[model samples]
Target chain A: MRRLINRHPSRRMKILLGALPFILAVAIYAIAADARGADGPDKLMPGLNAITSAMSRLMFDIDRATGARLFWADTWASLARLGVGLGISAVIGLGLGVPVGFIPCLRALFEPFFAALSLIPPLAVLPILFILFGLGELSKTVLIVFGIAPFILRDVMLRVAEIPREQIVKAQTLGASSWQMILGLVLPQVFARLISSVRLSLGAAWLFVIAAEAITAEAGLGYRIFLVRRYLAMDVILPYVLWITLLAFAMDYALRQAHDAIPWTRFKEGG
Target chain B: MMAVIRLDNVSKSYGETVVLENVSLTIEDNEFLAVVGPSGAGKTTLLRMLLSQEAPSSGRILIDDAPIAAEPMPDRGVVFQRYSVLPHRTVIRNVMTGPEWLAAPFTGRVMGRARAALKSRARNMLDRVGLGDHATLYPAQLSGGQQQRLAIAQALMMNPKVLLLDEPFGALDPATRRAMHRLVLGLWAEHKMTVVMITHDLSEAFHLGTRVVAVEKRRHDPHAPHRYGSVITTDFDAKPRLARQIARAPA
Candidate 1:
């Protein structure tokens, strides 16, 4: 028999090990809800059945006033804001970051300023953004852009700068002009890194979008969560939080798949 | 023989540190010149000066009896010890990059019949370097020897007047290095280009060069090492022995 430290689990055992904690947490929640008594007024931990029934109603029923499903409406609104904000950030990051990193004059001029911008706490400026853009879609989208754009830009700049000097010289010897170098040599490497930078920034992007919606929004995931807080609607809130987690995980997984599709990204430099 | 490149009292210094001093030499067209020196003797700095990547602090360099350009141009091709090939491009594309840039300045690519011509030329160059089968692979996917071959192919594709190599095969095993020596000698004879190769290996210098030049510092300061810089100390003709040896060696 192998010692415990040296022992490794089989594939089936590994899957079971990964699932152990989630099952334990659900079991604990069910037992606690039973102990509190199903008929009790304490709504802090609603039973699983109540949460499921609430989710089904949100999914299947239409509101009489609006004649639209609330769940889908909120999800679509939040996704749109996130998408528009990230798209703008990606454009700005690629446009400014490539030149700034490749050209020394531009790097000297803008690198310090961009660094300071990234250091600024984006949440602290939320009130200013709201005042300037008004409490509308523009403000929410700007908030997400403000939160992650600088970070993405900074990552792109550093990556471009990190390209080996030898490669740059080789390209120059091959008769590449400044424009040609940016497009042929620098842009391809920076584009791959930008995908990774965006993937890493997703968590912060979600945070900013949710905060903007919770403060003031007609329809969004965060708005709905905040709206039901007065009634202690844990049954709806719990399921919504889980749904948001699932959505974020799916997006992250999809980006990873896209990144893997580019074959050269997986190539590691060998000496 | 017409002189292809000439260095006139060239000296380079960085602030308090002097790297090369008063180096003067002339290279003939179609001559293979191998430079050998100790570490920190500024052999690479000399190559950079020839490549026009660095301007001499004091002197001027001439090519075809005219001053060398301020920046690197396609007339001179170079391969460094490492990072010589673009990792993002496949093997054949790396070789095609030179002509593609020359033909299409903005896009760095060609289309239609031009593209096909460039691809065929690149393929031919790859075949000469023995990398024809690995043309679809990335540089990172290749072994050290294969990567060096790819770098050589990429450089040769431009049909440069002067080919500069700085320890191109320094990272390869001995067997691969010997193979590369034969490949480079064959290429040099075929292309009729003046070649300047810097190496630490003395035997390699004697084996491949028509003429061998050695650079070293004449004087050293005990307290301040940077007070003096390296200069060309030895230059000799090796073509007689090299010719005799090559005639006997198998291709």
Candidate 2:
């Protein structure tokens, strides 16, 4: 029923659903390559079929990919990277952004400096990160972390700064200490906005990880797709691309649901 | 009880322009002192100085004979002109915040019996203010009058010795303002806390204050140093007639 349709797909299911396209392309190529023979125009058809067979095959794969072991493992690898990156960013952003935002002199000295630093594309830092950490998980994580943390810090800092001045003064009058002001007055006010910024950073982390994986990884879906591209095996590459899109879609949906679940935002602003 | 607050030779200036000059006043225990002044007068500056949110260029403000210092003294609470209830927390939480923060032992930790007691005191204050039904509601959900009442409850919850208000009803409609005035007066009477409020409305000052302090320009100088007159305290003894007399006087 509608309940079945609305139930959130698991990460494994989403990725398998994504790779279903490659499965169908392989089947189609197997059939066409057998019937038309690679001596004629059949090789060209597989290349064309890689693109056209992708959409319908991905759709069919959504419900059927639940049983694959590698599918689940790849989903976990990507999710673990995302989880670690986002978790680290949230902690660092709150720790740094709150004080920097609330204190005017500190904000004046640092905000512009962070702004200037964030302007450089995160992917461009890959060279420096690899040179420092080499081709390890640390380098990949560092790229994703640096890619996401600055944007989150900037966002949270602005949100903290924009809290109504009256709220701060009111807290002060109520005998809130400096620490209590940050905890009670500032954090609650900025919590929703911070969650949103985290969502954006999470999405950015996923995108950054794909690029990171393609370059240095030998195991992730991005790595698998890059490996397949070497043999002009559109069949494997196309499926992995579809898998990534499905994963992104599912992750975005879950985060949005989490964002909506926040009780303060569920109630309207003036209500 | 001793005079709870004493201000001596207090002067404040924004750059070269003087706001208050050599102003001196003493507030007795449970005294309701309303300060009335024209626009741009230093009434608010004087209140801020008393609260230690601002320091005078010269002179001193003492509470229980101790000078107001950089650190917040638990004996005072201030209600601002704006309705500043945290629009996120419930009314009870907002009311409890003051007492829960300043009271020792519990102040260090907002858990267990301390939190439970805070909830009880906050609920009782809200009930007293007739906002018992709305205790779980946010500040945004309340009417302006209700928010002001909640502000009052919040201030009183701390059991402060001296409560300061800056035009608590200034932004409300006439009917709402009058109702708030009565409500505040009733709370002050019940709690017997020293109250100091600032307002431009002469009638409001006379209606609420045991004594009204008027701030006016004692001298005008187009050039050279400007001099502000000391605060003139008018004891009304809770009489409305004296307010009329002051209002009837020619400018």
Candidate 3:
């Protein structure tokens, strides 16, 4: 028999091992909920049935006030804000980062400033953004952009700088002009890297969006989660948290797929 | 033979450190000039000077009796030991890049019939380099030898008057290096381009060069190593021997 440290699980065993903790947690929750008793006025831990029923209502039923399915509406609103904010950030990152990385003058002028800017805690600026843009969707969107754009920009600049000097020299020999080098040579490589940067920053982006929404918003996952907290609505809150986790996971998985699809990013330099 | 490239007492120094000092040489048209030296002997610096990627601190480098351009241009193409080909582009796209940039300077791409023509030409060049079947494959997908072949095809696409190679086979295995030697000799003969290749291998220098030149420090100061820079120490005419060998082998 192999030592415990040396033992490697087979595929089926790996899956079973992976699932053990989740099953144990659910069983523990069920046992705890039973101990607390099913009939209760102020139960801290909601039963599985209670959470499921709450989720079904959120999924299938229409809200009396808005006459809209609240969960999807919140998801749509959150996704829209995330998409717009990330799209603008990508454009800015590509536009500024490429030139900053490629041109020595620009790099000298802006690199330190941008590096300083990236260090500023983006959450610290939320109130300022609110004061400037007001408590509308713009403030939340701006918060997401402000939070992640600098990170993406820095990643892109580093990536552009990391492009082997030989390729640049080779391009120059091939008669590529400055603009042609940026557009044809640097841009494609930088753009592929931008997707990866965005994927990494998605967590931070989500945090900012949620924080902004929690502070002030009529709709969104964060708003819903925060709004029901006063009543100790653990059932809705638990499911909503799970849903957010699921969404974040799906996004990360999708971006990984997209990054892999490029076919060249997997290989290291000099390939 | 008329001289295609002439370096007139060229000296390159970075502040207190000198890399090459008072180096003078002339390369005739369609000549294969192989440069060999130990590391830090400025062999690559010499090749870079010819390619116009570096400037001489004192003297002038002339191409066809005119001063070479400050920057590398389509007139000279280069292949380095690594990262010569763009990793993101497919093999065919890499070959077409030079022509495309030449035709459409701003866009870096040609359209319709022009693009088709460039593609066909690129295909032919790839076939010449034995990479025709791997047109759509990215550089990362290629082996080292195949990538070098792609790089050669890419350089040849420009129809450069002078081709600069900086240890192009330095990273390859022995068998692959031999195969590349044959390919490069065939291309040099067929294209009739003035070639300046830098190598560490003396045998390779003799095998591929019409003229094999060694760059080394003529005088050394142990206390101040940077004081004395490398110069062309030995210049040998290998053309006659090469011709005789070719005659015997008939390959």
User: For chain B alone, what TM-score does every candidate structure achieve against the true structure?
Assistant: 0.94, 0.86, 0.94
State the lDDT of candidate 3 residue by residue for A162-228, as single tens digits. Answer: 9888899999889899898998899999878999999999998889878988999988999999999
DockQ leaderboard ranking: 1, 3, 2
State the displacement of the C-alpha of residue A72, model 2, in Å, after optimal TM-score superposition. Answer: 5.0
lDDT of 3 at B182: 99
Per-model TM-score on C-alpha atoms: 0.95, 0.76, 0.94
- Greater TM-score among 1 and 2 belongs to 1
Output per-candidate TM-scores for chain A, rounded to 2 decimals: 0.96, 0.74, 0.94
Maximum-DockQ candidate: 1
Q: Which one wins by DockQ: 1 or 3?
A: 1
True-vs-predicted CA distance for residue A211, candidate 1, Å: 1.1
Pairs in steric clash, model 1:
none
lDDT (C-alpha) at residue B179 in model 1: 97
CAPRI-wise, candidate 1 is medium
Using DockQ as the yardstick, the better of models 2 and 3 is 3
Clash count, one per candidate: 0, 0, 0
